[model samples]
Target: MILGLHHAQITIPKGAEEQGKEFYCKILGLLEIEKPDSLKGRGGFWLEVGDRQVHVGTEDDFDRLKTKAHIAYQVDNISYWRKVLEQNNIKILDGVPIPNFERFEFRDPFGNRVEMIQEI
Candidate 1:
């Protein structure tokens, strides 16, 4: 009854593609893939990591916290990711780098909170 995860979708605020590219590709190190021809005009970007893929789409209105959803990426180096995010002028959440798991949280231009974690 269980199947593999084909992909996941995240709704981004309108006009946030550039920032999304910076955060997801440059900062998070996810690979960008071409969107399917059928969804071309929908306005979004697709990213691949291992066997999973995430699709970021444009939404006229988005409320990050109100959506009660967030995505977490497992990283090998939290500090490096943190520095990358800060160097890009992205603000990170406070109180990160917990004992067993070093982590950092940041919001995309659309206000979606993304967290990077590494196990100790």
Candidate 2:
């Protein structure tokens, strides 16, 4: 058998799953997909964007202050995303320019780091 990258699961501290759903699903406009029936009791949510899927999991004892990894999304216009983030009160890090893309970073409500890149 062979395998390729299929999905990524992020663990959210304590009771932050609902916030994750609100941001990733509603704010980001990603479509939520129901988890398989056999895995119903597990706590999490899934979102589908094109062929990639992201899953956010809930953990009771996780510490919110700890440093965490993040996911990045490519956007058509960084300015538009900046406005959206500002409207939602999400803080955006000053962006740096790459060779062909401009990169901006931010953290989710639960402290999950995220980035947005737009072609320059």
Candidate 3:
């Protein structure tokens, strides 16, 4: 009896809300869901990803870390994402082969690792 993911929480530097919006919303094309009034004072916001979400939080002592521990999103078009990322100056790394999917990795605005995969 297992359930699916609720959401994934990531951290960004405090006071970078606009940049976060630019990356997650404008760049990634995720719809921005407004934070509740009770939570709005804390900074950060949410993005709609299917039924789940990606919750970004503000970290006071945030250090930009690049690591393999990341959240992977299933995509419709790798080529489209590739072009989009390139146009936005985001670096894309060809991810290791994993069965029948095309995979890649990139860093978000705050340097957190993110993975994208499209089924072959």
Best by TM-score: 3
TM per candidate = 0.83, 0.85, 0.92
lDDT of each: 0.81, 0.80, 0.88
In model 1, the Cα lDDT at residue 24 comes to 80
- Candidate 3 similarity to native, TM-score: 0.92
- How many residue pairs clash per model? 0, 0, 0
Q: Which ten residues in a row have the lowest lDDT in candidate 3?
A: 60-69
What does each candidate score in C-alpha RMSD? Answer: 2.3, 2.1, 1.3
What digit string (tens of lDDT, one per residue) describes model 3 on residues 85-104?
Answer: 99999999998899999989
lDDT of 2 by residue, 1-120 (tens): 757668877777656678888888878788999899877578787888668888888886665547657788888888988988889999889656678888888888877778888878
Clash pairs (backbone) in predicted model 1? none
What lDDT, from 0 to 1, does candidate 1 have?
0.81
Can you write out model 1's per-residue Cα lDDT over 24-106, one digit (the tens) per residue? 88767789999989997889899997889999988875567665477888888888888888888889885445789877777
Model 2 segments more than 4 A misplaced? 1-4
Give the candidate number with the greatest lDDT.
3
Number of the candidate with higher lDDT, 1 or 2: 1
